[model samples]
Target: MTDYKLGRDYARQQDQNDPLKTYRNQFHIPKDEDGEDAVYMTGNSLGLQPKITATYVNEELESWAKLGVEGHVEGKHPWLHYHEFLTDTMADIVGAKPSEVVVMNTLTANLHFMMVSFYQPTKERYKILIESDAFPSDKYAVESQLRHHGFDDQEGLILWQPREGEELLRYEDLEAILEDQGEHIALVLIGGVNYYTGQFFNLKRITDLGHKYGCMVGFDCAHGAGNVPLNLHQSGADFAVWCTYKYLNSGPGSLAGCFVHERHGNSPELNRFTGWWSHNKKTRFNMRGAFDMLPGAEGWQLSNPPILSMAAIRASLDVFKDVGFEILVQKSKKLTGYFEFLLKDLGEDVIRIITPENPEERGCQLSIQVKNADKTLHDKLTKSGVISDWREPDVIRCAPTPLYNTFEDVYELVERLKKILNG
Candidate 1:
């Protein structure tokens, strides 16, 4: 067991020495009525905006006002290829080659676009597998795809469920489903990180299992994108989609990122819904020929994207570029470990952490399950200036983001939780 005082003191000391600690000042930390910074642990929902975001957006707006239509080419950020500027930095963060990644539509939209190419279902092999508790949007997208293919969703869909009374899904269970239904399953679509339970699934292992069963595998990484290290290239999945609004800190409802494995990059035969943007860049504006798709993920784009949203992503990515994911993840492990350490000390009888205990199995978000206490406890914590998320029934999610959250932030949050629980 770690010494409580030592842990508390060490947390404070770590904040003092932290290289990324100064980044907290770069964001506008929310405050309570008393003028104190609210713990701000909801980065998992909507990340705090970087101060430079407005500046980045305003520059584009200024160019629009001054140059009018010429802003498409003459703006400080050329609107024509604005999305291209973000590709390299985003590819680095998601662990994909530049050609494999593209910034495009919102999360659900990208998922649909990916499905157009990857979720090809045939007569015998037509079933799609997904987590039983997948986010509502994903469930809807898959169901719609099934309907579009002339198959009843209930018949064409397969759900990999957790064991009775369990909050997290097991790989063994997933394997069992694949073994029993492997013959009929055509695709495996999974959430890279469970939004509610904060469980980080092993992507490579899942991909391997699905491939063994002759299934196409894809991932919806809304919660996992910036939260966990998703080596999409190494994971060998056919495709993946994720949003930037959460851990990527690209503001609310930002453009999403999609990855298409290099193996399929040049496969012109692969089917996808296309538009002018997906045509060859050299002759894109020629506007007089058949649709020749661009190679890799860029080929998936259906239309020109919103430049304002891309600007927010650019600003946030610049910060990530400066610090690097390696350093951010290192601090994340420690900060979240401390949060877990302190929560465990509160005793499991009163408050149970639903998230996995292993650091490698999760990012920084911790889902706390409070016994006998309902949302009231969450309300109390909020009143005390701790800004955490509350799910229905009884779960409070607190994400100690490494870019801004300090060790002291974790310590203080736990202390507040303990006081609320004891009272």
Candidate 2:
């Protein structure tokens, strides 16, 4: 909405004015056959690697080689408390207290772990609610949870689907579902940002509505974490989980994050799966002390962390810290807005964007639905030095990630698409 113009010069000017432009050098942008930078628009799927990631990972390797088992306590950034290294910055990224957030298992694994304590179901309130178009992993996880608890998966799972002929979900629809069946719903788990439509949900509103009906609320912030200002603590949900690879710029398949509201930090009554890492740190090495769980999100740790993955996370977070999240978000809105503007100029009849147009309603990603297009169009774009994501059927997801993607990248992408369409 910044009165975006219709030329490559405009994109270059915006990039020149971008304060976060230099930060792009900190990442290793992929290149095309001609050695030019590829327009990477899939940060929502897997973020680009930080240039310093190798250095950080190597340091851990050196520590392991030099200190052996002593590395647990003696290495630089000691393995004994490696996960703690990420706590503060990660807390700031997701807008949660350090004690409430922890970097641990994979996304789905963390979701299941969180559900073990938060999704306790009785005979009556056993149903779980999720978006109808939720990531397949989440759907599978919830269905398994229902089956494990002796409930009929098909009957117990409630989907908050968009109305016919619509793409974005409505908050009113969610409220109606909760109002009509809230009594039977034990948990309400939603993706913080819908992956396909890129619609950022109102977390606080959802949490309030779910809590009002006596349902435990949580969010799978896999797509929201670094892409948007989640403000998880302010959302007042019981818990949330996210993977660090997407948007977080941690290495692919790296550690994920979990957040348990501070209210449940020391709730002894809550049942959780605990292990050695969850025990009191002071006596953790004693090996004979009773299982006195650590308070807050730390108590959920099931085992020691992978230091290599933590190192990669540390590298990426350092970049986020130096740049400051606010500046990145500011750039994100402008970058995506410009992308939207360019796409809209392509003619609404020729292209459709399913992602919310409101700047506050989405992250950097725009899910484009091209008219009379298929995967071959996406293939052509790739051959034209654009790397993007193709959803099944017809949609293409492109995220102009603020940390690295530029206005020129967005502009060039549309040009390639326009060329292909015209040809």
Tens digit per residue, CA lDDT, model 1, 319-401:
99988988998889888887887787788887789899888899999999888889899899999899999998788999999
lDDT of 2 at 193: 99
Deviation in Å, model 2, residue 345 alpha carbon: 0.4
Q: Report every candidate's CA lDDT.
A: 0.90, 0.95
> Taking the tens digit of each residue's C-alpha lDDT, what string does model 2 give over 368-399?
99998999999999999999999988899999
Assess every candidate by TM-score: 0.97, 0.99
Question: Which stretches in model 1 have alpha-carbon errors above 4 Å?
Answer: 1-8
RMSD of 2: 0.7
- Clashing residue pairs, candidate 1? none
